[model samples]
Target: MRVLFVAAELAPFAKVGGLADVAAGLPPALARLGLDVRVAIPKYRAIGERAQDFASAGTFPVTMGGKDLTCSVSQGIIPASDVPIYFLGHDPYFDRRGIYGEQNEEYPDSLARFAFLSRAALGLGPALGWLPDVIHANDWHTALAPVYLRAGAVDLMSRSVLTIHNLAYQGWFPIDQAAAVGLNEAGRKLVASGRQLNLLRGGIQAADWITTVSPTYAEEILTRGEGLEDALQARRDSLTGILNGIDTSVWDPSTDPHLWAPYSSTDLAGKVVNKRALQEALGLAPTAAPLLGMVSRLAEQKGFDLLLVAFERMMAFGIQFVLLGEGDARYASFFRDAEQRYPGRVRALIEFSEPWAHRIEAGADIFLMPSRFEPAGLNQLYSLRYGAVPVVHATGGLKDTIRECDPVHDRGNGFLFAEYTAEAMLEAVGRAIRLWRTDPEAWRKLVARGMAEDHSWNRPARQYCAVYERVVAR
Candidate 1:
């Protein structure tokens, strides 16, 4: 079966968050199952080589705002896979520095930009004479793909599947702009929310199937849908929450070139070497304290505020802390100040480095994820593979993936805090620290248990294929 993936970001090309990783990981896994899968994304300026390496697949015209505009198409194969990736070029709209916006300010023309992407993605298939049986749209950026499909914007009759990565970001625009994007009169009437047009709602209503990143997240959004809970409630039967999987090759500690020393669940001596290296490199004293680390976008949703409050109490435990991420100016400034307040105890790298991320996962004794609400976190999964021993808030995928450590049996993988509070977080960390300082054998068993578990895309890929087959049958 031929399936087309419409997304705004693709890993190693254009990326902003976990969605990019999902876009890059899932397609290749699906292709291995003998399914003909193709991905389509906008040709942002950030996509290096300027399309010089891609094969020009000619051009197609997308009529928007009653105007027929031509769009250039370039095609290339995903690295190390047979899956084809199509790049849709519209220089005036997508040729910008940042993918979404700058300094927490989204591009004013985001609606028009992504609207063109949805229309262009639909047009890309017929232009290349390789129409797909199903079109899988991701997030609000490509949410309009389902709306366009239902409106018959293209010649092909493709089933549509919309995946809501995070419901917090529903593309809201002035209802007046709907006509410019060619939102049909019927769709406009249904998706209009007071004087606003919600792009995600439009897709949720139009798509044949809807999915969220995790099973727990799928259930949580029903009542806490930001503003569209009612809309989601109306279509509960169609929604499914599929847990996301990580790219084991990229996150594997045994072969990770980013690590100071390679280690596995079998021999954990290299973990100690990497941990000492991490402490020395980050300017922390090489003490016997348990090194705590986190690598996440420093946003409110990621529980940065809670971490700030919890950090003061956590310091009393004599644990070293390290953070690697870049987001929210406020959070960045606080962490920068933290380095001064606790010299040799705290290190916050205000940048996003893939190699550093891998190294941190391999080295840190305990990985912290205090997210208030997470859809499906990849870091926690990566931490498990690297034997970082995650101490995450028990919500969403974290609740589903992480099990509370059973000291009696030493069976469970990680620690979890049920409540979303600073004290709750500290208590969970305290449990892990106690395990580390007292019972070293049990700690090793817990870490090894997490490492032995499978979090690869092989299972998620098959789950997605089943969804695709169901939609096609309908």
Candidate 2:
């Protein structure tokens, strides 16, 4: 089976979030299963700077908005793997400093930019004489690929699969711009809702199969709708929810290069060294207080507002806090003020740094995630692998991945709370703290169990291959 992945970002080359990580990791895992898998992404400015060797494969013209835009295709390989990676190079659309935008705001021309990308991705296969059996499109950025294919823009035997990474971003635009995306009469009708063009909705309506990152997320979206729930419900029979898996090779604490000292489930002495090093780096006095780490965008969806509400109360438990992420000016300012208020106990770095992220995962004793509505969170998975007990709200992937610490039965990996409230989060944190301070043996067992679990891509890859086979069989 030949599979072509259409995505906007690929990790280690161009990344804005977990979508890039999935794009980079999934194809290779699929390749190991004896399936021919290839990935295609835009040749953004960052990708050119990071990816090493690339020779021009060919060029093609994409007709959009009554103009023919020339697109260059560059051939390369995914780092550490032999899977072929094709870059669609169009300077005006892709050669920018930021992948999507500079600040929090999205680029105004994103519709046109990604519309060209969807068209170019479909055209590239024939240009290279490597047509795929399945074209898996990801997120709102590449949602239009299925739409274009449904509109007969490309004559291929490929079946289209649309993966909804996040339902919040539906890519709604003025209906007048429908033609700009090369939408035909049927395509326009499929995407039109009132006076807007809903790209994600169109993909759900057009694609052979629809999938979300996790089963719980898939169910939550249908219930909450986020606006497109009705559309999702209408296509319920076709949708499947497969839980995402992390690249264990990149996240294994025993062999991680970014750690101060390597440690495993057996010997946790190195974890102690890492904790002290992290405290020194963050300018907090090294103490026995449990360190709680958070790496997330400071946004309402991530429940940063709840963290802000519970900050003072949470600090009263005699714990050290370290956060590394940047989003929302209000949350940034609040966390910074928190550092000022509690000089030796609180530290916040309002930026995204790879090394710091790995350090927090390896060093911190507990990780916090209190999302209001998470589709599928990656940090909690990373925290589990690093033996940093995750205290998360019971929703979506967090619900699926984490089980409440049950000392009586010697089961459950981390802490979980059902209510999305600050008090509930504090209660969960308190339980983790109690375990850390009182029952050292039980805490060790919990940490060991979390590390022993398999969160790699092997299982998820096989599930995806099954989806591809089902789609082709249709």
Candidate 3:
């Protein structure tokens, strides 16, 4: 099958989150499964030496706000992967210092920037003389691709699949820009919900198949509290939620060059060397107390606010804490205060470093993920592969991946808390601490179970291929 992947970010070239990891990782896995897959993303100025510019595949006209605009296409390859990546080289839109946001806020031209990209991908298909059997669109950025194809790009008669990474970011815009998106009159009529340009809703309505990152998340979106309940429930039957997978080759700690010691399920003693190294590097007190780690964006969605409250309660357990990430000001200030108040016990880095992230996964005895609503988490899987048990809030992929440690039979892989509250988090941490102190054999068994678990993209990629085949067959 010839599959065209339309995304805003792909790893190595440009990456901001898990979506970039998926864009870069999944295609190669699909390629291994004997499918012809090619990825297309914007040729943003943020891309570095790895990005190579190709000759333009001619110009494609885009109608934006009744104005004619031309977009040029350039092609490149993601290093190490055979998959070809097409870049929409429009200097006016994608040429910027960063990928998505300026500082903390999103750039004002996000709508137009991505809208042009959606149209450009469709326009390039014909220009390059390659018509894909399936067009797989990702997130709110490429939501309009299916919409534009439905409008008049009939040459793109191949079926389309739209995957929602996060239902919260719906790519909303002004109603005036809706027509410029190439929606038909009927399409416009269906989307005129009190003067909002719901780009994702249009894609959900247009695509042949719809999918989210996890089964729990697919069900969550149908609820009123989910924030995108209206459209999710509107297209209930078509949506499939396949849990996201980790690229085990990159995440595995046993052979990772980033760690101080490489260890696996069989030989976990080397993990302690990693822990000692982490304590020295982070300037922590360097105690034998179980080192708990957290690596994530310090945003409200990540449950950093809950961590702020739970840490005070958790301090009584006598465990040391370490955190690494960059996000909102409130959380940043809160972590800074944690550094001051707890001194030797709690160490917080407000900025993100890739090496530090790997250290946390390899060294820390336990990893914390108290996300308010997680579509799918990648770091937790990394921690599992590194022999670090996870303490995750039971939501989305966290619910799917973690099995709360079973003190009785030692059956569970990690610790889990269902309620989205600070107190609940405290309770779960307390349970994990109890397991660490009172039951060494049980704890080691849990660690081994997590390490042995397969969090690979290969299975998920095959599932995606199945979806593609089904879409094309229709």
| Per-model lDDT | 0.91, 0.90, 0.83
Question: Candidate 2, residue 84: CA error in Å?
Answer: 1.4
Residue-wise C-alpha lDDT for candidate 1, range 37-138, written one tens digit per residue = 999999888773566788988888999878888888888887778889998988888888889987778999999999999999888888888889999999
Candidate 3 residue lDDT tens string, 294-348 = 9998888999889877777788789989888888988888878888988888888
Clashing pairs in 1: none
Looking at model 3, residue 191 earns an lDDT score of 49
- Order of models, best lDDT first: 1, 2, 3
Q: Model 2: how far is 106 from its true place, Å?
A: 1.4
Flag regions of model 1 displaced more than 4 Å: none
Q: How far is candidate 1 from the true structure (C-alpha RMSD, Å)?
A: 1.1
Provide the global lDDT of candidate 2 against the true structure.
0.90
Q: How far is candidate 2 from the true structure (C-alpha RMSD, Å)?
A: 1.0
Task: Look at candidate 3 and tell me the lDDT of residue 168.
Answer: 79
Q: How many residue pairs collide in each prediction?
A: 0, 0, 0
